[model samples]
Target: MFENLSERLEKSFKLLKGESKITELNIAETLKDIRRALLDADVNYKTAKTFTETVKQKAMGQNVLNAVKPGEMMVKLVHDELAVLMGGTSTDINLKGSPSIILIAGLQGSGKTTFTGKLANLLKTKRSKNPLLVAGDVYRPAAINQLQVLGEQIGTTVYTEEGCKDPVKLAKDGIAVAKKGAHDVVIIDTAGRLAIDEQMMEEISAVKKAVNPDEILFVVDSMTGQDAVNTAKEFNDRLDFDGVVLTKLDGDTRGGAALSIRSVVDKPIKFVGTGEKMEALDVFHPNRMADRILGMGDIVSLVERAQEQYDEEEARKLQKKIAKNQFNFDDFLKQIQQIKKMGNLKDLAAMIPGMGKMLKNIDFDDDAFKGIEAIIRSMTPAEREQPSIIDGSRKKRIAAGSGTTIQEVNRLIKQFDDTRKVMKMMTTGNKMGKMMGKMPIGKRR
Candidate 1:
């Protein structure tokens, strides 16, 4: 994400590579390159110029402290300015009211529906809120159904009325239903138009007036670049949305929308849609984003994702099984599934503090456990519980039945045994492991 812009900014900083102090001349050269990089990345030209001006003034005015080098100082100054430009701090979704109403607004194909589902899941799991997803997109039956499937996947109730043509009424009734069901959050997914049309604007505005929503999030496709900023402005002018949701940030987004939207509309970016999964939503932090733009990986977010996926109950249950020596193929497969659900393997692997640059070209399949899963599926219940029951002859038969070579099956068993040993160490001496440890297994393997 923003790789091109990251590369460009890194090059701009090189102008101060070996300088003891920043001068106006070197700062001018660096700011010129930075301005061009921003323009190339589809940032608003005027905003880019203003950004460089701020950066340059600060670089020239600041006393280059003895503790930091010129390059480090420039990076720090630019990072701070970028954070302020993108709204100095994160703004959380307002869920204060009983059955707090959240209205989703955006253009067609802006991923409004997907984002609604994701937001509902986030509220339910992360915030411990009982959320009711409301289908307010009456224009498309498919849109309602899509939301239904997402609600089903997340185990949330969806409120919808058949043939309800009025989105305002649907949203009102949806909130009523949420209140009746003791839900704490109500997320209404509103309709979107192909472009910023009058009808679309009026429809969403009516919903806003009727519901008196606590939060109205304008979802914009980051890939839309400048158009995203303009659309945000249009929506904010009409509904005065509380925050912005930038979707499709995982793709080759030109960074313009993110850089300009806040400065343009004066609304903090509440969250970003990094991927299509319900688990892909992240609260936007300006300082953290600035770090990512400067090629520093987001380790904080990476750790949070892991913590969310690691269930305490499941860990305790597995630990008991390990002590009893009852850990089996089925348990190992379940662990793999849990890890895959956390996120994309390649992206998650790149989040370790020092592993991003190293794993850039290494291809790690999330489905690397597919063969092992198949092999385990072929085994009988007894064999799964007791691998020793599958001797040499049994292994040959299992391999043939599972459509894998005997050697491949043997490798999986050996890997599983090794994994158990490592897990025992992790559970038994967790503190010792943290203090005297090597890298995570993912990195070493």
Candidate 2:
């Protein structure tokens, strides 16, 4: 995500290293570096200036504790300020209206249609709401087709008129359909242009007035930098959107749009598109984001993602199996599937404290687990249940079936055996059971 900005900010914080306490001269030097780092990250000039000044004011006002180092204190101040700069906290989308209607608006190529599908998937999977997607991009036939494909992929209903050119009418009709179908949420995906135009603005405004949507989200490509902020301002002036959606955020290293859009439009960022999958959307959390940006990791968000895939009954069964030293390849395969469902592998790893910097030069494929899954799947049910019985000849056969080498099979078996021993130990003293009890799983937010 904000790889470059993170690196820059870390270096700026190093200016206070070894300092016994804060001082005007030392703080000025650190603030200068911080300001330059923000500018290099494509942050708005005005926003950056205001942010540094506010951070400075707070830094100077702090009564540094004898136990806290100057570098540690400065980092804390900057981290809190960064969180405040990104809207201070997360904001939930309004869905109080019966068959709550949401309007999606943005410039073309901003991932509006994809975000629509992702939002529907989140509502359906996480919130337990029946959502209907409306293809309101009447100017583009391809958009309608795209929406249909996404709707099919996510198992949601999509409303569309074959040849209708009026988006306002499509949205109204779509809402009526939602009410008839007893859907709890209706998301209308509006059309976008290559650039801002009067017709685009007026058409979206008309739809907003007609539907009186409970929420209007402005999607923007985070990689567009300051241009994204400027475009958001223009849209807010016309539509007064309820929240902002930063798309392609996983691909944006500078993070200018995510940092500046809130300050420019004064709208909380509701969601961020982390990847291409329908499950890749995440509720925006400013404090967690600040943690990630400052190399502190976001353990809370990471645990929440794990909790989403955690099944209490399944975990209980798995615990019993492990207690009896019965954890097998089939069990291991299921665990991998649950982890894969959590989201991108690299993104999940980055949530661990200090892993972001360690993984800076490494490339993580989303399919990193494919080889292990294939190897496990190639095993016979007997072999999966009792891996210790596999001999040399069986290893050759399994390796050939899995398109892997015998050495790979040997490595996997060794790793599995080692893991089983550790799990057995955890279960021996009821340690694993106690940890599971402490986890806040199966709880509604």
Candidate 3:
């Protein structure tokens, strides 16, 4: 998302590459480059100026250790300053009160309704809270239907008053329904205008007054750039929102809204929408985001995603199968499915250290595994269990069933065989060493 900014910042740091320590004279050009990078990313000019100044001040004040290069020290200083610029720590939504109410506010087409559904899904699955989606967006035709569809997809309940034009009444009644039904959380999706208007603002303000919500979230489309930050300020001035939610962060955005909104509006970004899926919502962590923007990778977030898909019992079973060389196509397919559930493949890969830079120019499609999956699905149960059973005739049949070439099938079989061999060697620690020794002298450790 912040690809251009990351590259520019890297180049800026290179200005100090050969220097032994950070000095004011050498740091000026680097700061100018950093400020230019932020400005090019659509950041507010004043915010960018202040950010670079703060970073420069910090960099000049710190004593560089003998082990730390000047370039590395500058990168760390900028990373810390970036995090401070983007709300130093993550903020949690206030879910207090009986049947906690969360009011959603934003401009039209900001992905407000979509984020509402995602928040409900997160609450239901992660927090174990029974959340009721309140379709309070009375102006937009089919808005209730959209919320209902999202609720159905997420297995959550949607409360709607089909003909009700008064959002305040709808919000109040929605909370009442939630209380009666014992729903732990009520998320009210209010109406939004294409542009800020008096009528729209008043209606939402009246609803906020009526509901007295525990948390008010202002949803913003990060791709809107500085416009997003300006809109967030207007919303905060009117509704005094508790936090911000940046949507469509996975798009080709400059990331100005995420970096500048907090400084401008004095609000924390509670969550970020990474993809279109309901499961793509992530708690906004400024430090981790700073790391990602600097091409340092977000290993903590990567581990968290892994933990979300981890199952202790399943891991033990997989370990036993690997040890016995019984990890077949079925098991391999299951592993692929688990990885798919962890959000976008390219995004996941970017979470690894140094992988983001390697993948910067690569267009990684999430469906890259489609061919392998199709080939495996076309296999018979016996063939999947024992891949060795698939010979020349079976390969042709499987190729036809999967809409792939016989050569492609052969390639997949060879890849699977190689993977199994490597896995077997891993399981047998001594065997891995023996295999390495068999390689040419120069190639072997």
Candidate 4:
């Protein structure tokens, strides 16, 4: 996700290293490099030029503080400007009307259907809105079926006519169904062509005119880079979309669409599709994204994800169990489940400051926790409650049951024991602090 651009920008900032102040002379090379970095990331040439100019003007005008180095000051200026380029702040979708209508439009293969499902799931779970998914794609084969599957997976009713060829009528009837069902929102998934055509544009226009949707979201595949921005502009010209949805952002995207679409289309990026899962949709936040691009990480989003899966009652009970030294394999397994529910492992890791660059070379398997989960599941309930009861024979049996080796089981047990000891120390805060104080410097481990 803009890894190359981030590296280039970091290198550009290094141009100011050891400089006394941000003079135009010292900053010329850095600004050039920053502009080149943006261009390489497929940003609009004009936008890139304008951004660098704005950054330079601000850098030269501001008085640098003694505590802040030239390089550090430059980075701060670029970060804020990048945020402004991406829309300055997040924009919420309008849900003002009763059974608010949201029209989804895009070129074919833009993840329109998938994003529709994700949006429905987001509104249903987060906003407490009863959403009705409407399958408006009648031309494409199995488009309706695909939406139906997604609707079922998200536990939302999908409104589809068995053999309706008229998308405008389908959308209209879908909204009617929402009103009938007392649904708070109606998301109509419109059809798309491989390329934009007059017929396609006209058909979508008709639907828009008929429905008078509260929001029309133009979804685009972010991996397409500048093409995504161009497609968004074309769609906006016809439909005047309310927002943009950049899908497949978790892929190897250069991030041009996210950075350029807002400025080009004059619409805020309302959402981003980070992964394939229905729960992967995120409300686009300019500052957080700028932080990610600058390798600053997004700790606020990380905490928000954790809080979503957090349960106050369960947390209090877990704390008590840890304080009493009663945290067991079952509790450990439950903790793993909670983490897994938070979203993709690598995505979560990237939310931590500095972890993105550190883990960029590592490949995270979707089943990364499978072995540990299997091993824990293989244990008897009694053994899970009291792991000390497991002896040599029990280790062999559990390893065989989990399709693992005895050494693997032994390694897990060692790790678990260490984790329990550390957890106990953490619960006893002063004791843990004193232990840290007693440890020899540079030999703490």
Candidate 5:
């Protein structure tokens, strides 16, 4: 998302290359470039100035270790400052009340409804909370229906009073229903106007007072740049929200709002909406985000996503199968499904250090596994369990069923067999030489 800023920052560091230390004389132009990069990214002018100034101070005061290059030292200082500029640490949403009331407030097109559903999914899956979604956006037609659709997708309950025009009353009543249903979390999605207005402000403010939410989150569209910051300020003045939620971050966002909102409103960003999926909500981590912005990649977050999809019991079972050389196409298909659950293919690849730069020009299609999955699905159950049983005629039949060439089917079988052999050798701790000897030597005929 900060692709332009990352490139600019990289170039700025290059200005300090070949320098022995970060002296004022040598660092001035570098700092200027950094500030310009921030401004071009749509960061608030004052924030950009303060950030660069603080970074310059830190860079100048630090001792340059012989082991570390001057450019590398400057990068470290800027990364730390960027983290501080973006709230210094991640904040968790408050879910401490009897039924934690989370009121979502934002502009009409800011993705409030979608975020509500995502938040519920997060609580249900990660936090183990029974969340009840309340469709309180009565002013927007079909808003309630949209939330209901999301609720259904996440398997959460949506509490809506059809024909009830009073959002404040609806919110209050929704909380009551949550109490009766023993729902531990109540997320109330409120109405928003095209722009901030007296009626919109007063209405949400009244609803806040009525419900006394445990957490009031102002969702903003990150693509709006500085306008998002201004809207956050106005909302904070009235609602005094607990934290901010930046949505549509995966879109064509300049990333100014994310880098500026916390500083402008003096609030932590609790979460960010990365994509359209209900599982796309991520708890904001400032240091990790700083890493991503600097093109350093976010390995910690990548591992966490992998852990979320990891099943210990399943791993044990799979290990046993691999040890016995029984890692067939069905097992391979399950592994692909686990990877797919981790998120976007390109995004996942970007999490690995250095992969982002390598894939910067590559268009990673999300459906890259479609062909493999289709081929596997085309197999008969018996063939899936016993892939070796497939012969020449079976290959032709599978190719036609999967809409692929017979050669493609043979290639997949060859790949699967080679993968199984490699995995078996690794699990068995076979010597490197022996493993290489056991590897398949030629292409499938």
Candidate 6:
């Protein structure tokens, strides 16, 4: 996501490479480079100009010490400015009021329906809200069905009225059903026009008036760049949307929309659609986004992903097995499965601090453990428990059973042995324990 814009921004920063002090001349050169980068990313020219000018003034005002290198100082200054441009802090979706209603609006094919599903999934799974997805797209049966499919996938209930031409009524009826069903959160996914039209705008406005929703979220396709911001402004003018949802961010978006939408629409970007997966919705974070655009990795998000997958009782059992030197390939495979549950491998890899920079050009797969998994699955129960007992003859048999080579089977045993050794040291040496023990701490304690 935004890889192209990230690349362009990185190129701009090279103007200060090997520079000593932040001279006005070199700074101006770098500023021009940054402006060009933003323009290339499809940022509006005026917004791009104002941004660089503000960045330039701030860069010059900073008290640069001899210890601070020009390049490093410029990076830091740009990061600060970028954060401001993207909204300085993450904003939460306002789920206030009993049966809080959040109305989703956007142009057709802007990923409005997909975002609605993702948002419902996020609220139900992460926020622990009993969310009912209200399908208001009466024009397309497929649209209502799409929301239902996603609702099923996320284990959330969807409310829809078939042949209900009046969406305002559909939404109202959906909420009434939700109330009876004991749902606390109601997300109304409204029908979208091919483009902004009088009929569609009025329809959405009517729904907004009828529901008086707690949050009116404008979802826009980030790949549309400046147009996304412009459309957001139009929607905000009509609905007075509470927040923005930048969708299709997982696509080849140039990063212009995320940077410019908030400033243009005067609304906080509350969430981002990082992928098509229901779990891909992320609460917008300005600082982390800045780091990502600058080719710096986001360790905060990486740790959050890890914490999301951490189960204390499970961890305790695994630790005991490790300490007793009984940690087998099955445990290793289960650990991998738990990590996979957190998120996409590519997305998780991007969150690792500095890993994105190192891996920008490489094609990394989430199934990096596939070969290991196949080999382990082919192993007999005894071999799984005692990998050391698998001799060369056993290796050839496992390889044939798993449809892998004998060398691959041998490599898996060696790697498994090495992993157990590391785990034993981590469990007994108190290194891993100290780290896990110092977590935010369980509230029950």
Model 1 TM-score on a 0 to 1 scale:
0.89
Clashing pairs in 5: none
- The C-alpha stretches of model 1 lying farther than 4 A from their native spots are 317-327, 362-366, 400-403, 424-445
Question: Against the unseen true structure, what C-alpha lDDT does each candidate score?
Answer: 0.86, 0.92, 0.92, 0.92, 0.91, 0.85
Cα shift from native, residue 241, model 1 (Å): 0.3
Where is the poorest 10-residue window by lDDT in model 2?
A: 193-202
lDDT of 5 by residue, 89-151 (tens): 999988889999999999988999999999999999998999999999887768889998999
Higher-ranked by lDDT: 1 or 3? 3
- Among all windows of 10 consecutive residues in model 4, the one with the lowest summed lDDT is 191-200
Where model 6 places Cα greater than 4 Å from the true spot, the runs are 17-20, 379-383, 388-401, 431-445
Candidate 6, backbone clash total: 0
Q: Could you give candidate 6's per-residue lDDT for residues 1-445 as a string of tens digits?
A: 7677777777777888888877788889889988998998888788899999998888878788989888888889889888999999998878887899999888888899999888887787778899999989989888999999988898989988777899999989988998899999999998886445888888888998999999989888888889888878877877888899888786668888888887887799999887766777889999999998887888888787678778899989988888899898789889888777777677778877667767777876767878878888999998888887898899889999889999888777778788888878877667766767778767324
Per-prediction TM-score, please? 0.89, 0.94, 0.94, 0.95, 0.95, 0.91
lDDT of 1 by residue, 1-445 (tens): 6778877898999988888899997778889998999998889888998999998888888998888999899989988998898999988878889978888998988999999999988988888999999999999999999999999999999999998999998999998888889998999998886445887788888888999999889999999999889878877888899999999997778899999988889889999988878998999999888877877877888888878889899888989998676788889878878787777776676566446556655777767767888899888888888887888988898899889999998998898889888777666687776755667766653
The regions of model 5 sitting more than 4 angstroms off are: 430-445
**188-247 in candidate 2: lDDT tens per residue?**
998886346887788888999999999999999998889999999989999899999999
Error of 5 at 90 (Å): 0.7
lDDT of 6: 0.85
Give me the overall lDDT of model 5.
0.91
Output candidate 4 Cα RMSD: 2.9
Q: For model 1, what is the alpha-carbon lDDT of residue 300?
A: 88
lDDT of 3 at 445: 50
